[model samples]
Structure formats: C-alpha cells, structure tokens
Target: MWKLNPRALKYLNEVARFGSLRKVAAHLNVDVSAISRQLAQLEEELGTAVGMRSGQGFVLTQVGEELVALFRQQKASEAAALSRIEALQSLKRGRVSIAVGEGFIADLISAPLQAFMARYPGIQISVEMAGANEATRLVKEDRVDLALVYAPSPDAELYSHVVTRQPLELITPPGHPLTRLAPLSIRQISGYPLALIDQQFGMGQLVSLVEELEHIRFEPQLRTNSVAVLKNFVLSGMGVTFMPGLTVHSEIKQGRIACVPVPHPVLAGASAHIVSHKGRELTVSAEALINHLHDGMLFFN
Candidate 1:
C-alpha cells in the first residue's frame, strides 16, 4: 500500500506554493503541527527529505519538485474524470464558472445570464467580478472555466476572441463647458480636474494617451476602480472622466451626463474579449457560453 496519501500530497503542494507550513495550515484551516507531521510522513514514505528550512523559509528538494509535478498531474486527471462524469449527464446541468471585469458585468453579462437562465434554469452559473489582470490569471490557472476581459497585449499562453469594440468617450456632468465643443483635444481636457482610474486598470491606457498629447501629468482629484463611482463623481460636478461609450449611453440619453469625442492623439478604443487557457480543452458549458457570447456580440454591433 502507498504510505503517502492524496491529502499529504495536497499539503505538500500547498506548502510549496505558500512557502510556509504555518501559512499552508492557516489556508487549509488545519493545525500547523498537523501539516508538519503530514510533511514528515510524506518524506518518510518517499524515503527522502522533501523540504528543508533555509533562511527562515522552506525550500523544496529536487525530489519534492518531482513529486509535486506528479501530484499536479494526478489532480488534473481526477478533475478531468470528474468533469467527464458530469458532462455525461447533461451539458446544461453542469456548472459554468466565469471571471469577468466589473465593467462588463452589468452591460455584457447580465443579458446573457438572464437569457441563459431562462432557457436552462438547471445550469449553475458562477460569475466572479475581477480586474482584467485577475480575470486573465483566473482563466489561465483554470480557477474559472472562462473569463471576460479587455484584451491586453497579446500573450502566448492565452487564446482571446474579441467580442466587441467600444469607443472611449470623454464624460462630464450635463451642460459642462466641454459638451459645447464638437470635438475636444487632449490638451483641452487637461485643464479640468480628472477623475481617473488607477494605472493598473484597463482604462488607464487612455490616461497615457492624454498625458503624451498634453505633455503634462494629471493629478486626479479622485481615483477609483469602480465605473459607477466615477460616473457619480462626474454627475455630481466633482470631476470629468473618460469611459467607454457604451457605459455612459443611458446617462447621456437621460441628460445626466455628456460625452464628447476626443481627438486623434488621445483616441482610445478597447475590445471586450473572451479568453481561455491556450491549449486547455474547455468544458461543454464553457464552450456553449462562449458561443452564446459570440452570438450576443452581434447585437451590440
């Protein structure tokens, strides 16, 4: 009988990832001593030192590294088997997990989710709101079956399908002075106190364009990750912001906000993308949803 159990392997993997047995224990909600004992048992079963303390950190041995690779393969095989068993029932009955940016949640995902739920009420759908970077990471790590993100620069490990292209518009409170202009240049907008998204966000690329055109740095009166907050700030006469045209459409029509076209050097466009791990096979439900999103993009166009 194999002395090392799957639980021990899981502990080893966790320790390797977290770098501390205490952290692994906390994450797994187990006692630190228990994790230590498990590691000792695993090392004894394999007849090798799996990990060693170095400079107040645990470092995995070569044997530990090899074992971790095998353990991950085993886990993946188990997951595939489970997925296959679930898929055998009904594709629509299985769960589909998607990680998406907050900006796309209300406009893009809400309608599709409503329609999908109406058709297949039994299908479980989990939507996690994450930033574009986190969305990419979640999809690549297989934590989520699919992700909706703004396409960043191309990367070899991801396969992206552009769902829709949204134009960026300068948004301000209704009847703001900028609304009177047919088109405004970056320099013209630089005079206002900007309410901008931070540099890590997808929309931050737009700020870079304005910076280059105006040859001056913007000191935002407010910086936020939430589009709703930025919209509210603009509406309340706090500051102006740049956002995708789709996001401000209702407000623009309602006269709560005004959107003006920005000129050439400061032009901004972003594409909504459905991304998946480059070579991984997507679950049936994930594939179905991807197809649905592709179909849905036609309506937006």
Candidate 2:
C-alpha cells in the first residue's frame, strides 16, 4: 500500500483548489517553492504527474482530481469521527456545505435554513448555487454535503433523501394574456414572447425535453440562467418565463406574477430532490439539517 504524507496531500489539495501554487502559498503563508517541492515529491513517489501547467495556472489530471477527492473524503471522515466524540455536547460545532439551484434558494432560505441556523448557532453552513448536473457532481465529489436540485436526473452514485412533486409552471405578468389559458400547451406558449433559462439547469433540461417531444421550438425574448432574473423579467412585464410554482409564491401573493400550468408530462411531473453522495457517512450536523429540511421545508411538503 502507498502511504501519502498528510502534509503533501494538504499542499496538493490547496494547490488544486486555488489553481495556482503561488495562490496556495500566499493563502497558507508559505513560500511557493516549498509548496512546489512537496507536490514534486508526491508525484515522484506516485510515478506519474498529478497535474500539468495550463494557461496561467495548473489544471489537475484525472489522477490529480481523484487524489484531491480522496483528501476530501478523509476530511469528511475525520469530521464524522469528531462528531461522534462531540455527541455528548449535543453537536456544539460542525460545518456543512450544500449546493442548490437558484429556484430553490428562496424556499430554502424562507424556512428550514433559517430555523436550522437559529437552532444550531454553532454549526456553520455554506450554500452555493449550481445547475443540476454541477450540483450532483459536487455531492459525488464530496465537495458538498447535500444538494437541492429541480428535476434532477438519476445517478447511481447519489442517494435521494427527499423527493417532491413541484410542477413547473409558466410564469406571466399578472393578468397577462396567457392567464386566460391555464394548462397551456408548449406550442401555445411559443406564440408569446418568452424568457427562458438555458439547458445547464434542470428546469431548462425539462423545457428542452418538452421541445424535443413536441417537435416545436420556442424563440424567447430573453435567455438567462437565473430564476431570479426570469422572475424579474415577468414582473417587469418583459414577457413570460418557465419555472416551478413554489419559486414565485411571493410574487403570486403580491399579484406581481401569474403562474399557470404547462401540460407537458415532464413539466407537470417536475420534482425537487435533496441528495447526497451514496454510501458516505455524513457528519451529525449534516444529517440533522437533512432531517430539518425533510420535516420543515415547503419543498418536501
């Protein structure tokens, strides 16, 4: 068995994250040459290059990424071990990272997130917004403890803790012409000026699927990757957009946006999934948040 030095692994992981030895060195208050030496020794021991110089920085090779992922797993294990030891103290402290789609951000912040942070003030949580594919990749890579994705595709390496039907709706300006036609077809929606997200997002993926199945394409007045922007576009009366109904509840309540159903099977059956890496043991804090979301969030309800 090959034993990697802990210090060397630390240097490698930091370099990979920062994408530059100099940046890692500056962040760690060490000399760039020192960090370089450690990585060189690591590569020599492994008999292969971990990464190569790219543009202005270094990019990891496949082996390099795997090694960084290994370091992350080891850190997660250590955190879990510490959590067990701290059980008597009632989870006094820990950290959790989660990725989410922009559409789910408001719902997460509205309830479960606020309640959890208030209850567990000592536990730190970091949230990042990512597309469905990127969200799954982050959890699988151990970069995040959990993810909240809309219309997530199946993956063998992930486990879904919560899945709920949160159908995609066509968002329009309040009292807009589209509201007269609830449960509109995709072809009908195309006749109006539209705003849509690109295919990197899960909602966008479902929209693309609908277009393919129905053999019709939509020429949108605007294209973006943000649900917030799409919401604003509708509120500003630029045009209609497509997203989950839960995302625009506040706007609907304020009579700023009108959400109508789209009858495509994919849109009608859209779901929100909270997932984690399969077969990995979560720290006590992460598990608690998962339960909180399952029990408290409107997405799960």
Candidate 3:
C-alpha cells in the first residue's frame, strides 16, 4: 500500500532539483531541520534511501528518480482532472500563463486576448514579455502554459501549432532614400546607418547567421533590446532598423514610417510559432487561449 502526501512530494521534488536540503529549505522558507526530518520520514515510509551525499551535494538514487517521475505524472494528471471538473461547473474559472516575444506581444494579444476574456470573464490570464529563447525556456520548464516566439528551434518537449512566416523588413523614417528600393539586399542595406537589435535579445543569432552567410559586418549606429527605442531612432532619422512587419504595422499604416522588404536569403525563412509542452494534456482554459491565438494569427499575417 502506498500513501500520497503532497508535503512529502514537494520536499522530495525540491531536494532533487536543488540537490541540498538546506537550499531547498531556504527556497521554501522553512527550517533546514524540518525539511531533513520530513525527508527522513519519507524515506522510512518508503523503505529506501532516496538521496545520497556526493562530492558536490546530494545525488538522487535510482529510486528517487522513479519516484520523482511518478510524482510529476501524477501532478499533471491531477491538473487535467481539475480542468475537467472546472469545465463541468463552468468554463469561466481557470488561469493560463503565456510567455510572448516582445515584438509580437501587441499583435498577438491585441484582438484575441480581449475576445477570450470577454467570452470567459472569470478566467485569469497572465502574459509576460520575453525574448524568443527565454519564452521557449519558460514553456519547457512549465513556468508558462504557452509560448509565442519568433524562429524558435524545434523542441522535442513542445507541441507547436499556429505557425506563420513573418518576413524581415527594413524600417525607416517617411520618405527615406531606402524606401525607393522595393526589395533591398543585405549589401545594399549596409550602406546606411543602422540601429540593430542587441545580442542579448534572441535575434542576435539571426544577425550572426546573416553576417556569416552574407560575409558582411554592419557598423551599427545604435544597438538596443527595446523595439520602441529602435523605432524611435528610425523615426528621428538617426538610422534605419530591421524588424518584422508585426512590430511596426501600425506605424507603417499611419505613414509615420516606411518599410521595404529585406529580401535576404537568411531572413526569408523566419517564422513565428505557438507552442505548448508535449506529452501533457492542456487545461481547457489553455486550449481556449490557443484557439484564440490561432484565430489571431490568421489576421496577424
């Protein structure tokens, strides 16, 4: 016979992740002795040593790994069950956390988020703006229920849906010289002062790839992580910046900026995707949010 206790499972899981009882206790804001005692009690009940001291810190035994895996599976199953229960009562009560790339956050949430919340007023929603890599990491770590990112790598742990290709564009102040060029090549665009996204943002890899493929290095007038700052620089006629259409769609429509397609080989294949964790069933609220995103993407393009 096996007894399930949430407290025991929580302690074990934290210990497995932190690799030290003291660290886990600190993270949980509990006394180290209490965590040690609880862990010892868990081991006694299970009749096995779950963790062993190593040179660096605690290492989980085989039994511990199996127990942790089972605990995760059970936790996921319980969450799914709760979702079903909530659906029976009403679809209005649930929460979904979404991590989105900064550039697409406005377009991604502008129409769809309002619609979803309007339909289900009781549902709670949280959206965090992050770079593509950080957004993918959040989804993989289950820190967020879903992720919307540009050019994310294929992840085995994620199920991608609602994919869309967004071509890069050269954004400039109105009546800029580059606007005369319908499609500008990388070499041609390099002639002007440029404001580029910094390496800290995930798009730096794309820039690096473009540099390698085109064999050209740009002497940027400015490099920043904020899209707004880049837009301001271009608006002020300081320099031109490259960005996806979604980032500057409104400005282009209002004639505050002009955009020419950047027909670079490296940028032709850039895409945006909505992804969720693989192998785990999504809650009804999460599923509803995904449906809204899918609908939003149709118009986003």
Name the top TM-score candidate: 2
Query: For all candidates, what are the clash counts?
Result: 0, 0, 0
Residue 90, candidate 2: alpha-carbon lDDT: 93
lDDT of 2 by residue, 204-292 (tens): 99989988998988898899988888988998898898988889888888888888988878889989998999877788988899899
- Kindly report which residue pairs in candidate 3 clash with one another: none
lDDT, residue 220, model 3: 89
| Ordered list by lDDT, greatest first | 2, 3, 1
Q: Give the per-residue lDDT digits (tens) of candidate 1, residues 1-301.
A: 7656788888888887778898888898999999889889988887889999887678999988877766765654565566677678766476778887766766665477778777767668899988777778777556787887763546787787545666567888878888887667776777887888765556776676567766878778888888888888998988799887667666778888888877654354556678887766666667767887776643234
- Residue 105 CA error for candidate 2 (Å)? 2.5
Q: Provide C-alpha RMSD values for all models, in order.
A: 3.8, 2.8, 3.1
Writing each residue's lDDT as its tens digit, candidate 3 over 1-301 gives 9795668777887887788888998899999888778778888988989888787777889988777767766766677788888899789698889998778766866677888889999889999988877888777656788888777766787888677887667889998888888667788888999988866454555776899887899888898888888889988888788887778888888988888888776676777788887876788888888887787654234
lDDT of each prediction vs. the true structure?
0.74, 0.88, 0.79
List the lowest-lDDT window of 10 residues for candidate 3. Answer: 292-301
TM-score per model over all chains: 0.79, 0.86, 0.85
Query: After superposition, which runs of candidate 2 have C-alpha atoms over 4 Å from their true positions?
Result: 15-29, 47-66
Question: By the TM-score metric, which is better: model 1 or model 3?
Answer: 3
Per lDDT, the best of the predicted structures is 2
